[model samples]
Target: MPEKRRPGGNTGVWWRLIQTAARAGEDMFVAPDARSVHRGNRRAPRTEVFRPCLVGRPGGDPDREIWEGIVLDLNRYGFRIRSFAPFVEGDLVTVQLMRDEEFKYPLSGVLTARVVRRSEAGGGLMDFGMELVVEPLSPTSRSGRGIRPAPPPSLSRPGTRMHLADYISKGRGNKNR
Candidate 1:
């Protein structure tokens, strides 16, 4: 009669057999080429570019409120804005990107961004790279009721800074600067 192997003895033999089989498989395996590895992989979804614009802070100092920026790049997840102003490392700011003026509302999203890196652009312009913490505002929000009116043509342009003194002097009881 064949002797039945105990649990410990059987386990040791089983482990040795698994190691031997794995070693044999490794020895016979061939490394795949980088290009071939991605042959059947599905392509990533394409991301559309949105034209970014300035959004005023509701109650912030008008001088430093409107930031000149552009949506450098974007995905469904988040976007990167190139701005002249230096935002702190972890500032919660409201960002707006322009869409069709007639029907499509502006893209407004609240992002908690961290200053990932900062570099100097020529002409004393400071560029900040921020990593967003919050999910971008949905398209529905832009189309919803209570959409704010677009800013004037002059303020809409990039690189426009209205100092506090300038704002007070130009105040005609109108929100448009």
Candidate 2:
């Protein structure tokens, strides 16, 4: 067997090479690329828009303690969020989306996900990266069939009933409609 090399033994060499190459590239009047280096590695495209949401731990008092957040970006398999609540790595949480009626895509569902990464995002907020915990239905490759629809906004709030006519009237005066 070949001799096994230890990790981190030559870390500085790689850094030096990168720095020198970057300096050389800059000297050649090359413009810095605006695209991310990870562009080609993503499973799906992400929209750079914020969607309102509520995130909470399973079986917790969602009305009393649920943290409001914005879904920063999402792909086919995972999502990133900026939340008021702190989530530890490996915690399972349910994400409920607050739909915007003006948007063309109708978002309705509670997705169960495992928190794979978390970091402090300043101002007592946190950033989380969660992977969807979808269970395959059978021996075949059908996935994500187990996702459940989110609870209605009326249920989220206690003793508040919304009328459909009231909702429709609010949009009548808006120019976007």
User: What local distance difference test score does each model get?
Assistant: 0.55, 0.72
- Residues 74-154, candidate 1, lDDT per residue (tens digit)? 554445566677565555556666665432466664444555556576776655545556656776586676567788677
Q: Which pairs clash (backbone N, Cα, C closer than 3 Å) in model 2?
A: none
Please provide TM-scores, in order, for all candidate models, with all chains considered together.
0.37, 0.49
TM-score attained by model 2: 0.49
The worst-scoring run of ten residues by lDDT in candidate 1 lies at 37-46
The segments of candidate 1 whose C-alpha lies over 4 angstroms from its true place after superposition are 1-50, 55-64, 100-105, 109-112, 135-177
lDDT of 1 at 165: 71
lDDT of 2 by residue, 48-110 (tens): 558877788877564656777888888778788899876899999988878773433437677
CA deviation > 4 Å runs, candidate 2: 1-41, 60-64, 100-106, 138-177
- By lDDT, the best candidate is 2
TM-score, cand. 1 vs. native: 0.37
Candidate 2 clash figure, as a count: 0
